[model samples]
Target: MLPFSGNASPLPRNAGVALILALAAIVTASGLLLWLQARALHRGTSAYAALETEHLRVAAAETARAALYVLAADPDLSVDHPGEDWAQPLERDWPGGIHAWARVEDAAAYVDLNNLACSNQPGRPFSAILRNAFTACGHFEADAPVDALADYVDADTTGDYEAAFYRHADAPLLPPDRELWAPAELLHVHGFSPALFAPPAPAPDARHHRDELFGGDFRQATVLLPDAPDAPVPVNLNTATREALLAVAGIEHAATVRSAMSLRALHPFQSTTLLAAASPDLASTLEGAIDVKSAYYRVRATAEHDGRRRSILAYARRDPDGTVHLLQWLEGVS
Candidate 1:
């Protein structure tokens, strides 16, 4: 009481404790606000990235379409040969670290699987050709695969697998009995495996390279469906591989097929007349089976942006009136 000073008492213990608690609450609120802001920013960035990736994909697809239009407008649409503008790969670099590329392939050069079974006949010539082609590709029991596929698409009840066969299976599935919408649908057929139809591994030596040089490799042959189910699909002589020619003409006509390959290499056939003049025997044999032009083309487009990638596969069908239409489009390849 004698030491009373002008200054008031320092403070109550409870008051000091309350002040400390208030400071702690303010620190916690600041930290939580900062965390919420960071989360919002992260989500916004992610959404923008996804949008950019999709835009890049669409741009790549349009580039491929424009290239196809250019090809359709060419006056020499009668023949699809190497070194043509359409045959060359298209590549483009855009702003913001984006890149795109595309390539065109002749769909008519490949054997049409739809042509084989659409007739509803199991033992058609196309089926035999498919069997032979698969055999040459190193598949064992090739006939089983061909027969199973024929049964899958043929309308007739007479097939390798009948209704009774599917009834006892675990999945209890029946044949589609219709044209195949896509080549990959073959995997659903019995005796057809991915390993058998996959692209062949690269050759290890010069001898293997030489063997593949003349299209002896079965993997070079593509499996495509015809654009028009009712019309007969013809092979493009200008683009058909030697293996395809052999499959169509039979092994007995090997010499004539080799001759045709040589002639086409020198000068791609401009028309069926040119092909006939080059190899009369083979031409006459493949009259209705071959053509010098391709109405169907496959286009593959790929795009890359900001460490993201997208790709699409499209089929372009050119009409007789010179109008090109997109037959199919498959996206998100890789």
Candidate 2:
């Protein structure tokens, strides 16, 4: 019996099946080639990015070294002010689509967060500053933050906001009960949140606002310095924001802060004596919480090559002899 009844032919049916298999093979080969090409392209892009990042890192380091030189060349070691060349921003472009930007900031111009851990004092004077800062920046239980921070940093285990409180969070963490290493670490402490530290919206018109006091929103105005235990970091009179000046013990009056800032604007206070002599009302406030010189500075730099970007953050100290020493250097910082 012939398998093909009527006019059916086995040859045509076999040819059709072969044709379908050949088409399937072609489609599979094409898909495989496409995937391989895509993977190669991704690899090339990743390689280029890594190389660009390395180059940018070197560029950022060099820029920071140059900034240190600029800081060291200041003639007046007795004073540090924004009028100096080191305070200016740096922007430059190289021939190979490479661009760099750097800014030098005075660390003394900010409120130091580590001041909350005054281990020796019966009453932490800087606690008032942090509380005031919280009130100014957010609408939370102001005292809660200060007290919680104290618990986090204080050498004590018995507090309402101690390690036990943090243990109940979704991702439990243990508080070191030590000074904060950076400003961002506050997010880990109780009574602190991202909302409290987020910066305000940028101006649509691209305008620079000069009236901000330090720690207003906590993002740009606060710092964590490894200051001596139980000691409050003094705010620099020449460069500190009005908020920083207000946080000082005796400098509470707004009018007095304004008056001193006005005097500072006219001429940088060459000495605390000069400030006191100019205004007796401010003399007492300047006794300990303020100074005319800045010992600490931060160098922030960003480099861009083609479409890739990298950043570096650094902290440095400047001596009275016009020598600058790098304390910490962080790469790939935002």
Candidate 3:
């Protein structure tokens, strides 16, 4: 006989087990739902953050453009409105709680590309002093990778500097006709020092850095001159600060500078070839130092293009009027 005290209700036991299983399933499902909801919320927050960053960047960029327009409209903004410093905040309280501020800058205060002597002038005095410094700075350092760079770029090859560059490098050099669009290309040139070719580093305390001393402005720095448009303010040849002259890489010749000056003194050099013939001493001291035309201007602008933050970098001259132009602009954004 079955246990005398046992209740014969099999359905009761089955129901109890079923209820326990159902409770466990409900708990697991709730946990999964909570996890999915949390994940979705995280994703939404990240997307919102990115969108906000983009909005901030656009606002900052617009501020820069507006300031440039203002300056372009006023020929004497720099002198007359000295307090319109772009570094200051551009604050505003707007509807919908959207506010933006920006900073603006001029690039001429730093090293000017206008003064360097690496252009293709025919015969010009090498700046003994400057060359010595440059050489000491590793240009001619023994065993440097680019020791041959100057000789190659300066050589009067049937091909331009590009052809000479690849020819001088060891076999497997870039194809012979390849062009160098950036100064960093010098690293590939023969006789260049490893130091020169090595990437630049941020200062010990600085949090930023760049690969090239210059990004890609060398191409824009050259000038053909008599052909170059008369700038809003002419690049004073006689008084063209060394920075302005260095911008083209052609003005290194004392003769080129003097001749350019004399032409301005006599009138701007009307023809590129005549620039050299103007002053024998300057012409002889320099090679490829003078040109009758110029197409670019040296410009620098710093702004808060990221909206809430400001970023700054040197800009090569894009045009003479100091309007919106292009140059190497670096952002902290990676």
Best by lDDT: 2
TM-score of each: 0.83, 0.77, 0.48
Clashes of 2: 0
Worst 10 residues of 1 by lDDT: 210-219
RMSD of each: 4.5, 5.2, 10.1
Residues 36-87 of candidate 1 have per-residue lDDT tens digits of: 9999999999999778977888878876876787777766766678657887
Question: Can you list the residue pairs that collide in candidate 1?
Answer: none
Between candidates 1 and 3, the one scoring higher on TM-score is 1
Which numbered prediction scores highest in TM-score against the true structure?
1
Evaluate residue 329 in candidate 2 and report its C-alpha lDDT on the 0 to 100 scale: 83
Q: Which ten residues in a row have the lowest lDDT in candidate 2?
A: 210-219
Task: Please provide, for model 2 over 1-334, each residue's C-alpha lDDT reduced to its tens digit, 9 standing for 90 to 100.
Answer: 6455777655566777898899999999999999999999999999987777788887777777777788888788888888889999887665457788888889999777776676643333667666666544443377888788888887678788887898998889888778777667788887888887678555446586533443255654467775443466667888987666666533246566677789878888888786667667756645556778888899998888766777889888787787888777889844
